[model samples]
Target chain A: MIAKELFKGTIKTIVLKLLSDQGKMYGYEICQKVKELSDGELMLTEGALYPMLHKMESEGLLKIEKVNIGKRVRKYYKLTRTGKKEFGLKIEEFNNFIQTMKLILNPSINQSI
Target chain B: MGLSDEQVDYIENLLKENGLSYPPLLEDLLDHVCCAVESKMDDGTAFQVAIKEVLNAFGKDGIEKLQVQTLHLLNQKKQLMKRLSLLTLSVLLFTVTYIFAFPIDPPNSSPLKGNAKITAEFGMTFNKLKAQNQFHEGIDFKVPLGTPVYATGNGVVTEIQSKSTGYGHMIVIKHDDHFESLYAHLSEILIQEGEEIKAGQLIAKVGNSGASLSPHLHYEVKKQGKKINPRDYLTP
Candidate 1:
């Protein structure tokens, strides 16, 4: 299964969690970490990632800090208080949804799918 | 082989010439592209060839496509903001129009519009009891002493006076269209100068207080400081 198709509409929640756990991360670092952690199965595109980052930054859920990195400026994203709270709720909601889907898809003892 | 400042500038100039101008997005994309190209060159890839590989991996329109997507998102946000401010602007316009529209009363609602009664006629030749032959420029209303007299139209009270002689306890209201209405021989004046008076509002009480007058109201309508017969503009 292609990860991009499976990962639609969940970019903000994912980014929020990453920023919450990792503190501050620039765009390139985020792509490398996700690729490494997913074992190259989930690849983030610039088209998807940058737009989400800009939108969430506009929404006040994330804050941006620009720093001089070598020859150019690099922008880092970190979760705000609202972003951390949102990430926590989204994780709990996703866990409940997964449990409910599992109960329906793999019911036992004559509870047919 | 990390790309130098000049190489990064060259890449940025190339992308800018390709129509990517939003600053924050441009900076972020440029740094990422530069990092990718430099890392590939570290593995002995030729500089130009690595740059080509990174740009190709950026997809068909490359930086232009990403710029377009970011602009589209910001445009959606701008439209939402315009909608919110539009609601606020509409509410403000309604309130201003309402406060402005408050002062003007309806035209046919005047007291003299359809129900005027004249006790003494205007422009009457009164034989002089003194020297110059007097022409009565106003009409008289034969109401009882101290009866409330209504304003003929809407206006501001421009003048008021109480005297034992001519035009006693009088009120003069300045109306629109160069018109002024005077209510004289009043037993009591009920309005102040600079106070607004509505059509048919009680401004005085009728009484005999002026030169050779019975218990009545001496009413006058003037245009440009000249007294005109009130019957010319009023209906019975």
Candidate 2:
């Protein structure tokens, strides 16, 4: 099980990859998707996710849209062109890093691979 | 089982009363709390109880802690930008000062003060028993064992010899007029070969090292490798 502290660093990469794959997603939907993908092992609270999203939008990596859902407005995030390019590079780098971590952490599993 | 508009406004006002005034985080927290309470009601929990549990998840500081953390991150970004700009400004100021300070080289003064004897004069036959018949290149000044020798002009040090048979420890400086001067038989050389020196700059100390009868300085000025008399160039 991955800890929330460990997920903190890769949250940007997670959002970038999610937006690239799903086109656009609202804030609640993104948190639910992360939970579902991790088999409910990882949880992203509202406090952490919103600040990261706002920071990304400020950096021009993501664009936001508002949709009227009943009486409230839901904010949806979509990747910009720069965000797409960044996602491609970040995933490749992250995958290589994960493989190196795998070798160090699970040497017996590394023998078979 | 979505929350009513009245329920959303009640939570927002409660948050505002408890010091959650940062707007963006406040709005997002309100949405989060409303959704969580609605979901709990759908699962058979009472509305007020679910709201209490959901708000409790944000801890005793409620939305205030998250707001502080987010603002801190933005402050760090602002501080990093300020430091970078300050660094660039300092570098610019340094370059301006350096350009303005460049033309003040080669101080104007005589090399030696009026206290030493002219041991050997330039351009006539000067013999010390073994050095037969040769025109002396420059005036020899007989100073004490460790008398300070100075640069006679503003120039760069062209050569230095730590131990040569002819002149024990020596330094040669090239001046602005394509003229090079030599200070030889020095007991100690205080400047490096490539260092810029001004007139009256202390360069070495006098010693007896080369073909000489007593402790003295061997000074010579040359142009295009030919020796010139230092007497025509310097006053006493």
The residue pairs in collision within model 2 are none
lDDT of 1 by residue, B193-222 (tens): 999988878777778886645787788888
Q: Runs in model 2 with CA error above 4 Å? A: A68-72, A108-113, B89-236
Enumerate the candidates' DockQ scores in order: 0.39, 0.31
Per-residue lDDT for A1-113 in model 2, tens only?
Answer: 68768889899999998899899997778888999988988787767887788777766789978766565666778999988988999999999999999899999998896
lDDT of 2 by residue, B46-97 (tens): 9889988987887788477778777777777778879999999999999998
Q: What is the TM-score of chain B in candidate 2?
A: 0.52
In candidate 1 the C-alpha lDDT for residue B181 amounts to 84
TM-score for all models, in order of appearance: 0.58, 0.55
Indicate the worst ten consecutive residues by lDDT in candidate 2 chain B.
B102-111
Q: Give the clashing residue pairs of candidate 1, or none.
A: none
